[model samples]
Target chain A: MKKKIVVCTDLGPALSLLTLRDDLDVVVWPHAVDTECPRAWLLENVQGASGLVVCFKERVDGEVIKAAGSGLRAVSTISVGYDHLDLPLLASRNVQVGYTPDVLTDAVADSAVMLALMASRRTNLTTSLVTSNAWPAFQWTPFALSAPQLSTTLFSPKRTVGFLGFGRIAQAVLRRLTLGFGVSDAIYTPRPEAPPQVMRDAELLRGLMPNLHSLRAVDMPTLAADSDFLFVLAPGGEATRHLIDESFLRRMKPTSVLVNNGRGSVVDSTALAKALKEGWIWGAGLDVVEEEPHVGVKHVLPAEQGVREKCVVVPHLGSATHETRAEMARLTVVNVLRGVDGEQMESGLDLGRWQ
Target chain B: MKKKIVVCTDLGPALSLLTLRDDLDVVVWPHAVDTECPRAWLLENVQGASGLVVCFKERVDGEVIKAAGSGLRAVSTISVGYDHLDLPLLASRNVQVGYTPDVLTDAVADSAVMLALMASRRTNLTTSLVTSNAWPAFQWTPFALSAPQLSTTLFSPKRTVGFLGFGRIAQAVLRRLTLGFGVSDAIYTPRPEAPPQVMRDAELLRGLMPNLHSLRAVDMPTLAADSDFLFVLAPGGEATRHLIDESFLRRMKPTSVLVNNGRGSVVDSTALAKALKEGWIWGAGLDVVEEEPHVGVKHVLPAEQGVREKCVVVPHLGSATHETRAEMARLTVVNVLRGVDGEQMESGLDLGRWQ
Candidate 1:
């Protein structure tokens, strides 16, 4: 008998890679593109499945494990974050969890830089001036529409880029900043006892920025005070929640821009909004807000008032590029295809947690 | 008698560099910051000037030159272009023209990339969706807000960047593109008999993108046909006016973006608007339009309807960064100061046209 593999999200053509296998039965959710998979639908469909596919939006907790019963052996998601999955339970049951990590590092880094540029350049204000037909009267004075630049120039020769979490994505962002913008210095707060340096990236960064003055591991306060552009790329959870609060923001350069491209939970939206409103920071670009998807008028970051006037809220789209998303989907299918056959997933979580 | 240097516009504290020298008299346009110096006022004040400072806004035509009489020996503008000045007349009168170039190159190139990201990522669409408090209903499916990424990745290991003019700014742009985004290939059209390569940039590009597939000098048709992101960096005048018209735009890929960061005259705004409305190209990010400063609601590019929905019109702010503008102002003063004393201006334009 063919093993059943239930795919919860519309991962476009990547789903075909799974459905093509005659040895497995792939059950896909059929619906409009905009709507997410319903909880009941996932619980009902995951029954008697050897493998299941999910995006980050889907929940795979104890309730899901109970619903899928003992037959489920694999849970593959098309995202790097596996927060929704009950990992301990999965490990206890010998069920493997798979995710796509490095595949999205560059794409997310690109979006981070995009947010930085958009915020610093004040595209929101400039675009409004154009769309409202208020551009004709706009005169080009020496400083008109002027803002901080992403790149280093003769005037501001010592621009620094600081990353809250110096991991794969932050390293990628640093590489881009060094090469593209000629940033002179870098400061990052890596996780405790993180590898000092990846030799490949170290060599690459040096080659890309020959006159790179320094690259140092600094504490959070130094990161806040010294950064011309502070990027929040730390993980989301209890330890990191509100890490970039009022105290952190107060220490930042008033001319500096704050970009949060990681998780929304890492930044406090209320403090950030207040910072922007009261000129504690020049501008802000946020891809992930605390209360997202439903980041309506009431949300502090998108309130349409002074609090958010200088802030740019982007719907979390770190992996929302055609090529990246497609690759992620294919990788998701690949991970599940391997795991369901009782083999090792290309990028699977260590089931040794129950040890 | 002390030589008189008429500083026509407020150049911030960079003016102090000129004013501090007691060998010259300084005259500034004392008025509201928003208003440009009236033509009459400029004509009236430049009567016995030995050196004059102006930005691009003031037209240094026959009327102003005739008004300035024989005393005016230097006309230094804080800009790269000399279209506002009559070069033949200036040459005949033995007057020198000084401009600020190279200093603003990186800033403008940075803006070009910013526009590329903005247009391709649909920042206009996304920003509006965010600002209007309509973000709650936005769902993140695999392809939600998906657009062509600026960088090369595993899924798209063959992205190409094209330039209409391979000058300093375009080369700087290419450097950033290669370093920041990891574009795989580059193509450019240089002026006839322009040098094949700058060794430093060539080496830098090779190092930054070790897997750079190609860097070629191609013709216009091939540039249009081959590019995923076509940048219009060509000079503006009757010769290059409307160069990027309907025919060229139609030849462009549907996924391509046309960025005009060079000059307004090169791109025919009406043709671009139609192209955008009918989807001949995916999007356009224009820092310059055919009719600028006064590009009102009736203007083709900012018509507030179908014509510009997918287009992003930035008011010619390529060099409007705080760092770059200050550098340009200082350079402008240096040029005028040198020219006034019958010395070679640091970046003076050759007045050999009437030779």
Candidate 2:
């Protein structure tokens, strides 16, 4: 008898779970729209499955492992971060969790730079001036539409780009900034007890950027005070919650621009809004917020209106590109198939707790 | 006797005519706002002036040239394109024209890439969703907001970048595309004369861009057919007006993106609108339009509304950056000072017609 593998969402035939139909019993939650499979439906359909597939939205906890019973061998998710899955519970059940990583680094890094440009260039204000039929009345002055210049030039000599976390995505973002803007120097927060490989990676980045004279690993206060453009690419969770709060915002240069492509909780939206309104920072660009996907002009607080006016916010689309998403889907299917075959999963969680 | 010079706009002291106030009598436009000096003001104030400084907004016609009354040794503009100043007319009066070029190449190229990424990534649509409080109700699907990926990945391997006219700005853009996106190949329309130096530059570009195995000079038909991302960086004029019209748009692949940072008249808004509406192309990002600052969502036919929906339209801000604008102003001042001092202008127009 073929082992059952249930996919929580329909991934279409090109990246479908049904590709394993000959060797495994494949059950797909059928939906033609852009929504998650209902929780009730997932609970009912996940029974007696050897494997399960999920995207970023689903929260697979102890209940999910219980529903899959003793048969589940793998929990594969189509995202880099396995935040939604309770890894400890999965480990307890001997179920290895699989995730898609490195595949999305380029797309997310591209997004971070885009957000930085949008904020510094004031694209939202300028584009609205065109769409609202207000351009004719507006005059073109030297500084009329001018905001902070993102790239270095003779007039704006030094470009100090800082990263909250110097990881793969942040490194890619740094490469683009250096190549396009001729950035002079960089500062980033180092992880505690960083592996020697990460140190070599930082050195490699310094060599790649043409005008970059230095790439220093700095403390938080120095990073905030020195960076002309500060990018948050740190991981999400309790430790990083509100890392960029009122105190941090106050320490940042008044002319600095803040960008967040990391998880929402890392930045205190209310504090950021107040900072923008109070002119503590020039502008901000956010891809994630505390109440994201539900973010509006008033999502965080009444002060959140400042984000709509002074910030460029996009609904968590750091990896929302055709190539990246498709690759993620393909990897998801592969992870599950590999797990069921008793072969090591391609990117299975290396939780020492499981051993 | 100090030479009399009239500056049409006040470039702050950093790039101001006031810098030459001790050497020449400088008359600056009184207003602090972002508008061009009125034509009548220019005609009246230009009397007996040895040099006149102007931006793109001022039309240097026979009337203004005639008002200077033979004392105008130089007519310097703080812009690259001399479209606003009639060269033939200036040549007739022996007025040497000076323009700032090569200085702004980086800023404009940066804007071009920004626009390309914005359009292909659906930034406008996604940003609007966040600001309008619409994302909560919407579901997150794999392909719902998927756009033509700007970069290469395993799932989408090939990336073909094309240029309508390969000039300095285009070259800079190609460099960024190659470095950031890992593009595979490039195609560009060589100038009719096809100088040996131009061929050398293309070879140099291929060397600079890693993963770019091929870079070829192709004809118009092949350029349209082969490109995945088509950039119009050609000069603007009647000869190249509406170059990307119905036929060229039709020839383009549906997945191809059209970006125009060259000039307004190069891409016909009507044809581009139609192309986007019918899905003849994926999307477009335009920083320039025929009508320019006067471009409203209603500027073209009602079909043109499709541009507002499917395209990313920024105000004519290709070189609106603070650093670039300041440098242009300084160059304009230097050109005027050099012309007045009987020294050759830093970048004077060699109008052979004067001889």
Candidate 3:
């Protein structure tokens, strides 16, 4: 008998991997009206399945484990983030967990730099001026709507980029800043436990960020005070929540730009809105937000009139590129295939770390 | 004896250069209500002036030349373009012409990239959604606003950047694309007579664009068909007007992005709007448009409802950064000072080209 697999949602052409394999039986949810996979449907169809492929919206937890029973060998999610999954329960059930990481790194890094560019130039206000039909009356002046330039200029010769988290995504962003914009100086804060490793990785960092002149590991306050462009690319969790609040925003240079591409929760929405209104910082570009997807008129971010001028907000589009999403789907399928074959899975998360 | 110099407009603190030199008698137009130096005022004040400093709007033609008469030794404009000036007439009078160039190249290049990012990601539509209070009702999906990613990805690994005009600003943009975005391939079209130099400058180009693997000088059609990111960074004039018209835009890939930062006239606005509406091209980021400051709801570019999804327009803010404006003002002052002292201006244009 063929081993059965359940895929919670359609991953487009990546489902062609099923036709290539005759030894496995794959079932995908068929629905045109729903936004994401429903839990009741997933629980029912996932019964007796040898493996399950999930999206970010579905909960892969004790309930999922109980539904899959003893046949469940692995669970895969098509996201770099595995927060929706109950890792401790999955590990307890001896189910291998696979995630798509590294592939989306460059795509997210591109968006991070995109945010910086859009934010610093104040495209948020400029675009509004164009779309709102206000450009005709806006008398052209030499310094009118003049915002900071991301690339180094004759007057602003030196540029320093800062990162809230030192990781693959942050490092990729550093390479772009150093190579693309001629930004030579950089500072980043590592995870609290990872502080001592910063000095040992100088040579490694050189390989990652070419032409980087100064790469200093600083504290949160120092990182806030010194950086010309500060990027928040850290993982989102309870511990790292609200890392950038009122005190941190106040420490930033009045001319500096803040970009958060990592986790919206890493920044305080209320504080950022106040900062933009008060001119605590020049502007901001956000790919993620605290009340993202559900963000409305009542939200603190879009509520303030002054914030609209300085801040550019996109609807959580960090890894929303077509190429990145397809690659993620391919990786998600490979993980389930490897797990079913009783071999080591590619990009498998270590269960021991969760314990 | 102090030599008389007439400054047509206020250059902010860059006027301090005038205060530093006691040997020059400077008269500035004092009316704050007027947008630019009024024609009558310029003609009146320019009489018997040793040197004339102009803004982009002021025409330094036969009328002003006749007023200044034999005393005018030089003319400097605080703009990269000298279209308003009667360059041939100035040359005939043995007047050295100075215009600011090279200083604003990087700042413009930065804006070009910002435009590309904004255009590709459809920030034109996304930002409008946020500002217009329509974001609340916009349902979120995995690929709700999925747009092209600017940087190289594993799936879209090879990126080719194209330049319509192979000048300093285009080259700077190429360097940023290659270094900052990990784009390895580049192609550009040179002036009608400058194609042979492309093969000869390989080594020099390696220094300019660090990690570029391939650089091609190709015909217009091939460039349109092949380029992923096409930048139009050429001079604005009748000779180059509508260079990227229907035939050129039609040749572009349906997914390729067009960014014009050099000159607005080079692109045919009607064709681009039609292309956007018809899906002939994916998107466009324009820092310069044919109808720039006067762009209202009646303009063809903004009038097309379908165009807003893929087009991002900013009022001609090519070199509008605070740092760049200050530098341009300072250069404008230096050019005037040099011309008045019978010294070669730092960035004096060669009149031989115009002739």
Most DockQ-accurate candidate: 1
**TM-scores for all predictions:** 0.94, 0.95, 0.94
lDDT tens digits by residue: candidate 1, A1-355: 9999998887788777887899998888776266778889989998889999988889899998898999898999988888889898898888988998888887888888888887888777777687677887776678777889889876678889999987788888887888778888988887766767657547756765574778888888999999999899888888788999999999999889999888889898888888988888888998888867778667777674665657888778776777888888888888899889999998888778574
Which candidate ranks first by lDDT, i.e. highest?
A: 1
lDDT string for model 1 (B88-148, tens) is: 9989999989998899888888889888987888777787687677777666577777888
Provide the lDDT at A16 for model 3.
82
lDDT accuracy of residue A28 in candidate 3: 80
Model 1 clash pairs are A293-B136
Error of 3 at B137 (Å): 6.6
Q: Deviation in angstroms for A31 in model 3?
A: 3.3
Over 4 Å off, model 2: A13-17, A154-157, A192-202, A300-307, B15-20, B154-157, B192-198, B300-307
Where is model 2 chain A poorest over a 10-residue stretch in terms of lDDT?
A: A300-309
Candidate 1 DockQ, CA atoms: 0.64
State the C-alpha lDDT per candidate.
0.83, 0.81, 0.82
TM-score of model 3 (CA atoms): 0.94
List, residue by residue over A69-156, the lDDT tens digit for candidate 3: 9988989888878888999988887888999889888878888888898888888678768767888776544666777777776577
